[model samples]
Target: MIDSKQKGMIFNVQKFSVHDGAGIRTLVFLKGCPLRCRWCSNPESQLFKPERAYNPNRCLTAEVCGRCAKACNEGGVTLIDGLICFDRSKCTDCGSCVNACPTGSQTVYGYEMTVGEIIKKVEEDDVFYSRSGGGLTLSGGEALAQPEFSLALLREAKRHRLATAIETCGVYPTEVLAEACKYLDELIFDIKHLDDEKHKKFTGGSNEQILKNIQYVFENFPSLPVTVRTPVIPGFNDTEEEIMAIRRFVPLRDNVQYEVLTYHRLGSPKYGYLGRPYLLGDVKADDDFMRQIRAKLREYQG
Candidate 1:
């Protein structure tokens, strides 16, 4: 029996997302991930527990609003030269300052929500789902990392007769992947690199388990629609040889599709908000190079 009351740490519940799944969809971003990819955009989603993020640009100077500093019991927030300064080292992530902030600048990234509550919110867009063939898509730091809660959420979503999907890194146990597929209508899996060492070096986890899990999915669930994506990060999997290695690994079945996602620094600023370093720095993806690779792959396939 699936428990609707089971809670999961969710970072964001993005609405009207058109990328993760078919048509317009509601994306539930789950918190926690096993692998820490250097180019990861959602650094806030990396940790399991909720953390506070301070955006100085949105802060109404300390002179106007010192509420955040006043609310900080740990002396983490302070006013410096008309600017609100946050000392992340002292902050406990208790969310006191986030609550005190009048402007939306002080924000907490992750929060706990029950499957029942999440479903209730998702059902609000039932009209859009019916017309656009879109429903719930679970994205994360890694949805499979939160196995029980994620599975329960999927089951609950299915009970509501909604189309369900998940964007997974496929780094979990095959058992978890097996269970998740039963409830998922679409599977968006990331195959970062075929080489285990390179994969580990870049994403901080070996690709052996990931490859095995993905292979298990294909062999067992032949009917499930799978979209395998490779984020084209410069100095990583940008070369045709590297990308092709992964393309060769994935089976070319009718139900399986492959795509390359261009890397971007869109989430670099978030690192500053979270007081974390953006490892990728000034590196940028060559869109033209990626396009050429895609064309070459098609030609090779033909």
Candidate 2:
């Protein structure tokens, strides 16, 4: 077994997270992803390498001096239309500009961390986890994409006697997932679309393995807590027919819960900062539409 003291590259370690799993939890956001979902809310989590992000809203006038531009060696920082223009490709992610920018315009994604370091961070809130039944939640661009590191981290958390959960896209191999599942108390799986072709078109991968994995987990570990989440993306998989198709796959077991997450533009800005296009521009599911979809799913609950 690999030593848990080995460090892993992480994007963020969010603490006191409540919605990710049972109770108040610490969410470890791992880097790297295989699928490129158009509606992904955390685009920064996709790349394994560190990236530069420019927030124009946070830019200060060059009249104060272009210290950020002077600090960059890759010609990534430039002034355009009175706003800072960052060429992500030219960025080295050295964090020099981020430090030199008095206005906080330059920011970098991804950080290096070790399993022992993360466990120490999580242990800080041990009291809260025990009191509220909350523990650690492993989330990512895709946690299984970094299986070895993730598994090791989970093992370390278990050694500390903390409950663990994983939020996965279900795009990985069965063997890898099975190994990780052994250390998890709950699994939150994302099911974007029931149709294979549609799923491929949106998430850049077929539904063949994803659906199979869910079925496999349910059939083999019926007692394990599982939640199936569907992000209701507009013009994609938000139709009543699509929702009902997903409902059909939900196991009749009372331990399983199905949820429909309404789409939001929260991560659109990340695409811009990364110098990538935002496909779902200004497209978000309204509250009324989300409610209707939820109501439609309720009809099939019985």
Best by lDDT: 1
Let me know the TM-score candidate 1 reaches against the reference structure. Answer: 0.97
In angstroms, the error of model 2 at 101 is 2.6
Best by TM-score: 1
Error of 2 at 213 (Å): 0.8
| Pairs with backbone N, CA or C atoms under 3 Å apart (clashes), candidate 1 | none
lDDT per model, in order? 0.91, 0.86
Candidate 1, which segments miss by more than 4 Å at Cα?
Answer: none
Please write out the lDDT profile of model 2 over residues 218-287, one tens digit for every residue. 9888889999999989888878888878988887678899999988888888787767898777876778
